[model samples]
Target: MIIGVALGMMAALLAAVEVTATVRPDVVIGLVIGVPGVLGMLMILMSSRRWVTAVGAMILAIGPGWFGALTAIQVASGV
Candidate 1:
């Protein structure tokens, strides 16, 4: 539960850091896209109940999660 959320957040941060180091992305992009993305993932991972997960997932899907995911994808795809 809590552990999962913590791990997810850490993973997101680490991935973001790696991307930042490798890609040298703009500072704004890292904050705007990376931070929220990781935080959204944390929110989603923190969900222990079904309803909570649903809400978190929705929040993630709405924007932040995609931002985070896209940031990662950008690195992977070399875009």
Candidate 2:
């Protein structure tokens, strides 16, 4: 769990850096998706209860989906 948390934090940081470095909206979108995924994973690792872990996993899955959908809408709308 500790290892998972560490990896998740590291990945989130990396994704944040990537998002900052790029201008292409798609890569930014991906980074946006990734950051929350990592954070959710970290939450799962930190929590002791199975229910909390399950909720975290659900958040992890949903965050990226929201990001992707928002990105697609933005692209389609030329935002």
Candidate 3:
């Protein structure tokens, strides 16, 4: 749960920053629409039982992490 939340927060920051200057519309759209839902789902799953909560958080984290990574790459490469 901790790891998931940490990673998710980190990714969200990256995505948010990327959204500010990124030319890719999809990246902006995904971060705008998908991230909040994923984070909300992660928060909701915090109340679930043991393994379920952990799995849920991780799953939610991974989804947006990819877009964040892509955006980060674009920012890094100045593409």
Off by over 4 Å in 2: 1-27
For 1-79, candidate 3 gives per-residue lDDT tens digits of 4565556557657765665663567766576448656775866566557666666666565555555556566698797
What TM-score would every model get versus the actual structure?
A: 0.37, 0.49, 0.42
Greater TM-score among 2 and 3 belongs to 2
Q: Write the per-residue lDDT of candidate 2 for residues 1-79, one digit (tens) a residue.
A: 3444444455545554455453686675666667668878897999999988976776576554555455455577687
C-alpha RMSD (angstroms) for model 3 = 7.3
lDDT tens digits, residue span 12-63, model 1: 5666667555544576456655564666688778878887776565444434
Off by over 4 Å in 3: 1-24, 31-48
After TM-score superposition, what is the CA distance of residue 26 in candidate 3 from its true location, in Å?
3.6
RMSD of 2: 9.0
Candidate 3 backbone collisions, by pair = none
Worst 10 residues of 1 by lDDT: 58-67
Q: Indicate which candidate wins on TM-score.
A: 2
Candidate number with the higher TM-score (1 or 2) = 2
- Where does candidate 2 clash, by residue pair? none
